[model samples]
Target: MAFPGERSQPRGTILIANPSADLYGSDRMALEAARGLVSLGWRVVVTCSVDGPLVPQLRAAGAEVVILDVPVVRKSMLSARGMLSLGRDVLTQLPRMRRLIKDEQPDVVLANTVTLPFWTLAARSCREAVVVYVHEAEAALSGLARTLLTAPLRLANGVIFNSETSRRVSGWPGLERRDRARVVPNGVGGPPETLAARERLDDMFHIVYVGRLSPRKGVDLVVRAAALLRDAGIEPHVELVGSVFPGYEWYEAELRELVDELGLAGHVRFAGFREVVWEEFAAADVAVVPSRLDESFGNVVIEALLSERPVVVADHTGLAEAASGFAAAVLVPPDDAEALALGLSRVHEEWTDYRRAARSDAPRARRLYGPESFHARLSQALAEQAFPVPSPSMKDASWSPREVLD
Candidate 1:
């Protein structure tokens, strides 16, 4: 069945460009979207700025992986030097990308992140239709960076937001154009039924936080919350199952210091990056996402719910939307250690009830975010033509580095 805002199109070749080669939430969504397209008999090619862990996963999903040196303009790009560097990189790569697009001659080009809108702009000069998969909430973008990023979105034929939060945050040029932009929430596979039988361990309650260890992710807050729990006579074992990205070791060090200062070093375990964190979810009685920034979509929350584990999320931004679907989720104020501690205690005190609620609600949560539904919505976006796909123009003028830098 077609969703509210989609129309089916005949299958054809499509090129999907993502910013990174890592298998994070956005990367996984791109890969899954490629898989979904392939299932519909569409030939797919994927491109990334560099080669990393997710290349093999993309290949396994039957999509060709192309490594291109595309500059991903981050929030840091709002500065003069950063903008100059970004402009130079875009200018340097434009000709090569244009040639690549000409050679591939895809029917559609899917740019997979807000950081890489240059891909969509590149496709604007090609015969291909450009569709942007916005995985970020534009509220997180700096003013100048937001303007720069939103400029290219004006040229997109379609825009797919990972959540309503993203849609509202990103003031895309064509946001009011109903057929052009719509929301398609991220999807995840169902957990094994045996996960529902996870009883609280008598020795220690297992609390898990599975995401990047970064300042914005509030990993330090999770550690502080653990200390608060100890103060309340609850000695739960908090397992942090992720690591900070390279170049952010200082943040990781800070988190460690916070744990040490609280005298909860023995209570918290840092499990460095694991390719699959589902096992970590399965082992935990409670899952926590203490994010300081607005999350576009909370994949960890859904995973924990599917695993029949109660979730505790910061009560702000898209996190509330994510955890709101499940009754077992506990919401606490962002960055408040005492509140988080109380939340943890509440979950532990009502363990039996929360576990039962999670188990009972697991099927509904799984169905709401199942792969089939996501693919269905994605297919509709890919097939729909909100605006006419521009014909390839031989006289298309490339943007000057000066024009971009200015």
Candidate 2:
């Protein structure tokens, strides 16, 4: 079936540019969008900086994957030397981006993250409509840095914020002026069948945490919380189901040290990264997403809820939004281990009730975050941003950065 606004004939092509090929939160969302678009009769092309698991997944979803060295904004690039390097990259890559837009002649260019400012510039220079799918929200950045980072978003014909918090935190004044922005929560796919939370024969409570093992993600707090539970005479087995970024290996080491210091050697385990986490959620009595930093949206929260597992997440930003109104979710202050422990303790104390609530809420979570609901909302959002496709005669028109600058 064609999407609401899709024509009977194949809809025009869409080129999606993403920064990484890792199947992380944003990567998974991008893949979902590609799959939905392709199913709706749109030819999809996905571009990434490197090859990883997401490459094959995108291709499997019927997207043409292109490995390109796109200029992506990173925290390290704020330094003087890094800025110079970034400048050089932009100077060199911007032309290629413009050329790619010209060659693909897509109806819309969807830049998956706010990091790729040059993608918006290139698409505009090519006189093509561009939409930015914003998935990051760092409220801690200095005013100047935030402005500099988000300035390019003004050039986008449309902006798709992952959550209401993201749309608000973006601080772009023009977002509501021309109906240029829409908030579409990330669509998360759950297991084919809801795996009922297993009853533990032993007193040990299984707690699962998924996503990056970074400081900002507050993985250490989970360890501390585990220690707190132990101090309270509760046996909790905490499983961290993700790995850290290349430069952040030290964080994982520190987490291990903290686990040892807290004497949680047997209680806490780092399972590294997993492509599929349904089994982990299935076995988990409870899940925790204690992100200390701002998140645009929490896909893991929805995943846990859909898995019929009670979840404890930080009560701020998009995490709270994702967990809001869910009967099985427990929200605690960001970065507070004691509170996390307390929350988990409450779940343990009332395990039967919580488990029942989790099972009852699974259907609701599925209705809101399941693949069908997500695809429908996404289709409507994209259809709203549908700009008139350029005529075939105008497809060969030459455009350059100099013209855009002038």
Top candidate on lDDT is 2
For model 2, how does the per-residue alpha-carbon lDDT over 135-245 read when each residue is reduced to its tens digit? 988788877677767778889888999888888888477679887888888888988777788665267889999999999999999999999999998999998999998
RMSD of 1: 6.3
Over 114-179, each residue of candidate 1 has an lDDT whose tens digit, in order, gives 788778778887646788888877576677766776666677877888998888888554567556
Model 1's TM-score against the true structure: 0.90
Clashing pairs in 1: none
Candidate 1 has its poorest 10 consecutive residues by lDDT at 397-406
**Candidate 2 backbone collisions, by pair:** none
User: After TM-score superposition, what is the CA distance of residue 316 in candidate 1 from its true location, in Å?
Assistant: 1.3
Q: Where in model 2 is the C-alpha error above 4 Å? A: 1-6, 79-85, 199-201, 388-406
**Cα lDDT for residue 37, candidate 2:** 81
**Candidate 1, superposed: residue stretches over 4 Å from native:** 1-10, 79-81, 140-142, 172-174, 192-194, 386-406
Query: Residue 248 in candidate 1 has what lDDT?
Result: 97
